[model samples]
Target: MSIERIEKRQGATLVAPALLWTLVFFVLPFLAMALMSLSHLEGRSVVSGPDLRNYAKIFTEPSLLKGIAVSLEITALVTVISVALAWPLAWIIATRIPVRWRRLALLLAVLPFWTSYVVRSYSWALVLGEKGVVMNALVGLGMLSEPVQIMATRSATVIGFVHFFVMLLTLTIYSNLIQLSPNYARAAEDLGASRWQVIRLVILPLTLPGVVTGAFLTFVLCIGDYITPQILGGNNELTLPQLIMLQLGRRGDYPMASALSLVLMLIVTLAYLACARWLKMERV
Candidate 1:
């Protein structure tokens, strides 16, 4: 009845919708999936259970285990490569480009986001094909004696992921870079530091928050992505998401799929924790 109590009630009322939405949509469904993961498929029938067979199989079975490895490898490679490429690109745009053209440059950098994700993956498949542009150019330039196979391989998946994530990473790094004071760099230069030393020691270290944030996003997205790896990388290797789809589509194994999904979530959670810890350390 008091003003403070009334204001507290109003705050709760304002926050209720989002809290309810999360509880209903995310929490309930996650609980259902976790419960379903404990069940197992028995002779083509899902036996309701609170068992650990599916999780056991995931870690024990070599083929199933390989999917997790492949996903991790591809995700790590994509994150590292994107960060490597994006930093320089973001630096150039943030520092070198004219101030008037900066907005246009950012717009151009994110152009790939406008295209459909599936279409972009398929387009990469075409580009990496035997008779595709890359192959033709390489063959014409005598870079290779023949057109090599790139499509339907892990390399193709990494390439497709890197292409999209580079732009994403660029945006994050650029945002951080633009916020930095020019005086920081000028002070470092006045100390007789070389350009490379200024960047390597001063600028790069300051952007750790942005780099880690972008890399964490890249890891989550690249690991869980089904369409890109399916279309571009094919079944030569399977990521966790691709394997989850296979269980549902081909084998009708909901329990196993649910289990795999939990494993994926677990991996993402660990990544998030690691990032958080490091960021806290940075702040300290």
Candidate 2:
């Protein structure tokens, strides 16, 4: 056999395990779900048919449509807020902090990750409640005459998501910032650029990839999260994940649940495509 043939065989051997794993874990389950989505639950049993009823109902029903909108709204808000708050803190840690303490700073930045996600969500529920620490502090400080409604609202949901995803965004942005050479900023300043101009024109453009990556991650995680919204929003509104759970647990409608899961996957896939397109354009 030729040397090239031997090398090809070796390469295939290395790739075969990963391909098999993906086939078993992701592809097979997705195919099953796709098949399940086309069937309908009739009375107590699922009626197998390649039908569009689930898709039709998803688009036509007001409650289902509202769930999609709510999920998107919460995810968008979390992504934007996480990126905005994280970028400055990331920049500060990367650029302003001493090199020796930068590790400690980053560690402190991600301190919340040490706790359980469910625990954190429930903690926020209590903290944002009317009789919670935040409202009591506001009243005590004379900032509010009464405890305003915060818990069981969209605001609480956003706050909970932002708190968690901010750490993730900070790490991504900080990694990108630190990878950049300081000479870029120095050169911009020497060419008569102000500090803000250097940041706005040079630093921001270079860091766009990191910001987009982190935002995309935040979008996926926040949109799919059921615990935070279920706990913080207090069932005041439905999100896609909550709706999916309702279908599975209450209605026992596996077909509808599968369809809703596919919808969620489609949204994440579209987001990833958009990010990939933007990054390609930036490179060009």
Candidate 3:
């Protein structure tokens, strides 16, 4: 074989496993779920059929619609807050921190991610619950007259999300930050630009790719999360993932649940495409 043919063969060999895995795991399961969503629930069992009832049910069900809205709201709020918080921290880590401490800082950013998701969510419950640490401390210091119920609130859900997922956002942005040369900002300063101007004109624009990536990941993960909302959210804070879980686990409505899952997947997929398009535009 010629050198080009050998290289082509090696490349194909490396890609084959990944392609097989995707087909077996992701593609096959997704196809199954799509077919399952079209099934009809008959008595106690779901029967295979061509039905638009599942999709219609999702649209007409008030509770499910509310749940989706709540999930999207939480995801959007968390994405904005997490990205804003990550930007400054990433800048410090990438530009200001000593080389020796950079690794340690990165580790610190990822430390929360090392903890179990359940444990982290429960820990937030402990801190934010009525008569919990925060409430007790506030009462002790006469900051409040009564124990404030922080858990089972929308705010608490967002807080828990930030606590656990902020590190991921920071690390994502930081990776891009480190790749950016400091000379742009330095040159801006040398040209008698203010700090804000340097950031707006040079740093912020350069870091937009990372910001978009981190926000997209955070939004997708947060919106799909069942554990955090289930643990922290009260009746009013119902989320889409929780609703899906309720349908599958509590109601045993597999067809409806599969339909809901597909809807969620479609939304995330659209957002992913939008992010990809934005990234491509930025590259251009």
TM-score of each: 0.96, 0.95, 0.91
Clashing pairs in 1: none
Model 3 per-residue lDDT tens digits across residues 91-190? 8888789999999988987887777999989988888998789999999999999987778999999999987667888888888988888788899999
User: Please, what are the lDDT tens digits per residue for candidate 1 over residues 1-284?
Assistant: 99999999999999999999999999999999999999999989999998999999999999899999999988999999999999999999999999999999999999989999989998898899999999999999999999999999999999999999999999999999999999989999999999999999999999989999999999998888999999999888888999999999997999999999999999999999999999999999
Sorted on lDDT, best first, the list reads 1, 2, 3
Indicate the TM-score of model 2.
0.95
Q: Quantify all predictions' global Cα lDDT against the true fold.
A: 0.95, 0.94, 0.87
What candidate 1 gets wrong by more than 4 Å, as runs, is none
Window of ten residues with lowest summed lDDT in model 1: 231-240
Candidate 1 achieves a global lDDT of 0.95
Cα error, residue 183 of model 2, in Å, equals 1.2
lDDT of 2: 0.94
